[model samples]
Target chain A: MTAKLELRNVTKAYGKTTVIKNLSLLVEEGEFFVILGPSGTGKSTLLKLIVGIEQPTSGQVLIDGKDVTAMPPNRRNLAMVFQNYALYPNMNVFNNIAFPLKMHHSGNITQKVREVAEKLNISEILGKRVNQISGGQQQRVALARAMVRNPAMFLLDEPLSNLDARVRFSARSELKRLQQDLKQTFVFVTHDQKEAEALGDRVAVLNQGQFQQIAPYKELYEEPATAWVGDFVGDFPMNFVDGKGFRPEWANIGSGPYSIIIDSSESFGDIYYVFGRTESGEHIVLKSPKLLSIGSQLKFSVTRFKEFRDTPQSTVGNV
Target chain B: MVSEYNNPRNRKFYFIIAIIFVIVTLIPMYVLIIIAFAVPSQTVAAYYPPLFPSQFTLSNFIGAFSGYSSILQAAFIKSLITATIVGALAVALGFHASYGLSKMSNRMSALIISVLFFSTMIPSLTIAIPISVSFLKLGLYDSALGLALAQELVVLPMTVFMITGTLQSLPKQLELQARVDGAGFMQSLYTVILPLAKPGIFAAFLLSWMMSWDEFTFAVILSPVHPTLPILIYIDSTARGNILFASAFALLVTIPVIIITLVLSKFIKGNYLTSGVTG
Candidate 1:
């Protein structure tokens, strides 16, 4: 079953240092919400707060309109998959999946575990110890353990981070499919913007214990709400000139008003990413169709950009 | 150069050194066995005793268990029961205490553990009198329960230190995952933490048991009337100069230790502390 989750002005601090500032969020009953931020940006802390592992310093955590802020993690009835899977090393795959159901005294554990195991394609390994399984299979067992209970929501903390590149790619799609098929609320936390874009119905970009922007991944990439979000959300940090920020693709190289001396370039098969410094000494990266020689000057034109300001009240829309 | 050190000549030299080390360590135990098996006439009359027993007999062991109201038999049972209880209590109490400490800040927990370790530095004799006085006042001086509790002072520090290491080695995420999986605190502890920490807990138990089994100072002072095996051995050997009987009793004390070690060698070899949390 799915449940809408809401945090009303949650702020979590440990003594003198605040790990999460006053923040609020809402996830629709069946939406896949991703919290995307770099490491040490309180992304994991946010998930812990929502899952009731760490209490918020000041705020109410409401699940389906009921306050659960003071409830213990078990009482909150939410499932979480840790970054490391955290499968019971003492139990086999079958028992690991059956643990949650047994905790709730849910009958028919054998059939339930088999069903979820089959769905995850891990039925064959049900008799194997967790340590005997591959990382990919362990991840599936963690998911199977989570899904068996059909909790109100699922909170994932970088669950795909430990997988190899190819496995991670497949696991990401499998996770998205699982969420869609179940239609359950999933709040996933990770440092990878690519994963956020791939899975999130709405991505909240966090920085310095606060959210910089909460919007769709496309909106975040095209029109980041703040300079920090612009710098963080893309493969290349957005280039800023004279208090205005623009993505690398927004600047056309080799024939424009602004001039820069090429420092280096990286090729990506069809195109090159040229890195250089402008006349005013601002570092800029621009996309180039041809290889650009180092030390050669190039001109670029900004097709679109957003103006930023020292104060938070500055207009943030694209110009 | 490395291969030169690994030559057959050097290898033989190392083999000889290992044999010498083993002999040096085992000499006292070997002599104890020889003395235990030697006939009373051979042991008492000989000025410089032979390395091996001149004659073998079970009379010393039988005499200790059956002679003079059988004090050794009663004391043997007392020591076994007390040690087993102490082993269990130490593990039970130590694991809980260590789990609580493990949740604290590393510096805070380390400070507490160091304080616990310092308690062991004081000779048991210093506290034995005060403890026996307290035990007398509480009517627990000669009781096995009291002896077991008193022995906790000897074993609890080491137990906590060891189990704390074991608990810390396990990933904290597993416990958290158990909680999130709908298990309550005690439930998760029993279902996840306890099983994963078995090796360390058993090791701590075994150490406590052996320590209590051979403990003398507290047993002599607190339970003088009933007397643990070590105390009985002390009294018999000194009061009667029964070297043969004492050696037999000493050998009897090591039997359980040996059997326990053999049985739990599997757990010791598991190396669970280092490898418990695999990805």
Candidate 2:
């Protein structure tokens, strides 16, 4: 199937510094594509390129197979939810959601606004101003405003970053379900690995204006193409021993070759991590279901380890 | 621990300052009231301190109001028309200029703002003769519209400066979001930017109206044929030489400005801009 959005060798530079270097990707229709990275990794810049807010210095942005690199943001027919929600402070919930429809001069605006508001479960607070509602409701209003246009794709720039932790978890699931129900292309950007692992159909790890790896979360974690990708995509960062990758779960207590003295153990509810050092004084963590006493000795075996070459640091900018 | 203001010594200091402030500000109004109610005999008979209205007669107010009833009515209408036009024009033109200035580089914005500031600093008296000559040549003299246009030039600089501060405070993301939601430039400015800028515009309108309402030099020079409230007040005070009449007219002129300031002050508090923007 043809992709809904595609970037061809896009590059964005500011004077002497290049923020996004030669990068390209395709987001298929109905795919929940995520660009995961730490702050200032050119993730938001990439979204701006697609939405036509920031022009790429040299690249082509195609939406539905049309080159839209030169198009203005309003003409791009794509909606973006900013990190701060960016709701019009002067407008109430109903007017805020109906803003897009009024822009297009779409017929039956009241009906269309009501329909979107109902779907977003903000029907009761339609009369309340955006400031009167909670942050979660404001998020829904922003989403409803973007949805009233029914654009071809949605670009969310760290949409849930402003919410509390509990709200963020529930909002993540709601966003995923909403994407599934609408079957529209969704490109989400975030720095949290849990969000990328839980929400993306295919997660792309970006660093310093370069796409390190793009694949499903499982493959990116279990079979990372580079050492950087392996370090970036796990809840607990993957351990590197002698330039080789070993997942915490792959280490087991046995009579194989490696022997280690237990240093400490930390528990995170159901799972515990046992910190240990090999005989040669290499630090390693063994994932265990039960707690282990500190300062104990044990022989451990690694089921397997993945060998990865380090992607040279010279190619990407200093950011 | 006790707050500084709650201490006895500091409380005494505040009491003294409050008494001084009240005396300084209220003395003028008290004198004006006494003069308005004083009888003609008090001034002509003897130059005593007419601090109290010993003989309260409605004749001074009646005489002052009746003498200039026709001129006062005409001047009141002319001033209203001029002030309203000046306020609207200042807001419409000044808002757009301020928004444009807010987006410029800091050095450029500062340079342009300073230029506008200096333009306002040039006293209106210096330009009054030139403006009067130009207005007479252009056939714009003796017209309320001409007076309003003249006042607009004076009020616009301050209006634009105040509006620039307000626009700078508002986040630019709201406009960007409007653009991404499919609004054109003019549409976004009208729908998104102006509504959020209501406080600044309110303040600009208030300042513009107040400035034009009490303007004296331009009203005297360029508008000799079409006198405004200030010109009539000038005629009543200097030519007629009736303190009671002048006091009554001054009070009349102050009422509307006070009413407008009270009503629009609610909108100019600067609290609404950040209400729904930040959590």
Candidate 3:
């Protein structure tokens, strides 16, 4: 029911500009692998390649160690939930969910559809038309349609992005629980770091068509493999000064050898983030328990820092 | 603004204009009905023909069926078959062609559509002679199929334009989703694309049918012997100068168009192009 997916040196290019640069990856069976990247970084393109909607310019795509690069999307036995959900406008919700079963000529379509609808909590809306449902209901219907087929894996391309904030939070948890319940491989793609952290068993940070780091979200946060990964993985950009990189929480603002003139500060309840400049014009952000005013002098010390080389292509631990 | 438009004087003026517009547009149709239902004697009132007939009878309509070797019955059947063939051919060919066109870049598809439109602008009479010659050589002259193929020149361009717009407005994701749901290309088209495009396709079919039903140049040149309804009306009116019979034949020609339009009006209303895809 689940598959282990592999991409071997896959390179995709449009005209002369390459969008995916010789990328190789493996997603284990029943793993929730999240591809996290900013917009236009080929996140969705990678998903399409895995779903067989797109072919890699040069390399092979393998599912369960079997080459499937030449297979069509339907033959690949993968289901994809697009950002807009893409429900059939002409059909009611029941028919929309029953579409895949009908396509496969599977018997007991009504029973199968009812089971999936019950699991997705969309049984009440089965008779409603797609246009008559709200955005959240539409998303559930899309998921039910995908699930009804018992696909080898589910490929989700920003599936939660269209839902409102209130619904998105619940949808996120439901998606994670659904993946766990099915025990099916899921390749989820998103640009939101928080969503990546919340749902990914292992998040792969992609930038400029290459994976900067692929590890557990906690490891990606504590020990990022690249300076860009560190900045991209957290809420705030990691502070780098004098060839030393430290997270905001890793630096203390009370007293130490280094001193700075506070330029600005923002308070979040009991804690504060102070933005300051050193005498050598190095900008640093440090977390403080007490709120500090602007234009004030403060001393800070870095409890721990990663030394990055001064070269333009700075990788982590290049001391 | 609403009050000004609804003022008593302005209301009266608008009412008079509306009445004049309706009367101006409906006068020819009204006269046609009057002549068709009136007896021959009432239709020929010397110098001052009466607007309304003194007596109504089905004599003119009855005369159309019995007069002229039963040509009206034959021509009516021929026109129906020819128009039905043309409508089917245009929709079948246009839907597929437009699907392919919709996948191309906007500039590319536009260039091709404009070329198709340019082909339509060339007068059909200019090519009618050549087509008739080819049809004769192919041994298809004076046949319903030949007439239908010739009328395709008049209807295909509009069908392609309309169906292309409908297909283009649909999100490509639906088809892609269908494929992911274990469907082949043809399956996705029928299951997803065709249903969404029903309204446009029906509208295009209706227009094609009406155009083919009324087409004169191709019908006259290509199938003069096996004349369509329009040709039958022309022959009866010109040679026999039977205004009453011609009016009855013309009225018969409009029956199918009216019925088809009424039956398909519900399909054309509120086409659900934007509902499935979120903004």
Candidate 4:
């Protein structure tokens, strides 16, 4: 999959204070790309820029090779699900789903709504007002509302944050399946690394308004391009140790230059911080060792791992 | 932990307040209904302690409604027109202004809020004198149009105050979602913003209507030919011998205002405390 949507130097500023820096990203077609970051890291703002609720201070948004930088949200052909769900309270589930169709003036509005309602398992409550439905059903209606239009891109802003833990898990799986089935791009914004890892085809690690790295979920986890990305996308247990940034060949955990291996030079940022730890149950950290076997096509069935460090590492800008 | 004594004290306090409240409230209501229906007796000995009407008939309604097409009916019609005109104009302006204000920067938002507060603080009476002068000079004085326009200065700011609070409570995500759903800005406002803010709008409309209905100072000073109900009652009672019919005419205005308040009571959160006191 290649970029179906791209943001070129997108920035958003409020008067004197800039919220989203001159950032850029590419979301591949038919792929689930997550802009994962902590709160106020501009993940949501990036989604907003793509959707055109707010214009970039200076940037261009390209969709399928065409520049849609100045286009309104409707013109962008991107559907969004908000944290609040934003289902119209006055409209029933059926009408809410039918609204976009009616706006498009595409016929078969009823059949379309019914098809989506049935698919989303909300057909039973199609006649119920949004306020009268449960939170999960409201979310379903919101999703259905976005779905009925068949938008080119789906921009979700932590839509499951309000759900209970159990519901969140279920909605997550269903969402993944939906994306796979539709074969449409899904750009999700979330703080949870687990969510990004679980759902994303590629995860774009963002912090402080800039993207640290964008890679496939497993690659991002295993070989983070930057230390910030490593900390952000850490799922497998790996002890982060304290060490100064040094030349990759000369970087050491102890006395002399120790053997340090990386998948590629691209993962080697300007500085390399070495770390290592000892003992079976005791904590350990090292300048990450070469994650390779004698064979080039080796596969690891191992699922759990942890990281430990002897001393504290510097938490500098852009990690 | 709480004590049982707290409950007893609360109950005792409520009992005392309830007794005093009933007496104070019922006494005026009891007297107004009586005097409004009764003609003043020629003799001082005619003052009798009767809770029920000795002679109940529709004559009071007829007497209040029929003569010279009556002070009550004309005034009622006048206030109705003034309130409808002022309320609609004020609410429409206030509703959009608040939405515009909400989208502005904090400093600019502060400027708008300060303006709203400042306008409300300077009582209408302070400006009424100058406005009355200007209107008189412009040949706009002593007309219902003048009265209604003057009432707008009061009603507009109030409408904004109430509606702005309602709009502020609505999350910004709703609009963003609406935009993402393909609604244009105005479409989002009508389909999402207006419906969500309806409670506040209804409440503001009723309050503005009341302000226009009960606005006596301007109505009295401005509209000489077409007096609103309050002004009509004041003029009718003050003009020497015609004072005899004042109570009956006052009762007529009272009836309609009460009915409207009752019907729209669900939307008006603080109606009971402010109704008579404000007027």
Measured with C-alpha atoms, the lDDT of residue B178 in candidate 1 is: 89
Full-model lDDT for every candidate: 0.87, 0.86, 0.89, 0.71
Query: How would you encode candidate 3's per-residue C-alpha lDDT over A106-168 as one tens digit per residue?
Result: 999999999999999999999999999999999999999999989999999999999999999
Docking class of 3: medium
Tens-place lDDT per residue, model 4, B1-279, is 486646988879888999999999887766766766644452112666456556544454565556646555667787888888887887788899989877876588667777867755777778788988999898889776778898887788778878887788666777777777877878889987887777677788878888888887778777868788887777766863454456667666666667777877765453221111100
Candidate 3 chain A: worst-modelled 10 consecutive residues by lDDT: A310-319
Sorted by DockQ, highest first, which candidate order results?
A: 3, 2, 1, 4
Predicted candidate 1 versus true structure: per-residue lDDT over B1-279, tens digit per residue: 578668999999999999999999898888788778877656666887666665889988778777744676788889999999999999999999999999988899999999998878999899989998898899988999999998899899999999998898888888888889999999999999998898898899889999999998889888889999898778778988887788888888789899998887678654433221344
| Interface root-mean-square deviation, each candidate | 2.4, 1.3, 0.9, 11.6
| Candidate 4: regions farther than 4 A off | A1-3, A241-319, B1-27, B38-62, B105-110, B117-126, B129-140, B240-244, B265-279
Off by over 4 Å in 3: A259-264, A267-269, A276-283, A310-319, B1-27, B34-59, B62-69
For model 1, the superposed segments whose C-alpha errors exceed 4 Å read: A310-319, B1-22, B39-44, B52-59, B62-69, B117-122, B133-138, B272-279
**Model 2 stretches with alpha carbons more than 4 Å out:** A1-3, A254-264, A275-283, A293-299, A311-319, B1-23, B40-54
Better of 1 and 3 by DockQ: 3
**TM per model?**
0.92, 0.91, 0.90, 0.80
Candidate 3 overall lDDT versus native: 0.89
lDDT of 4 by residue, A10-59 (tens): 88887887878888777778989888876877878788888888888988
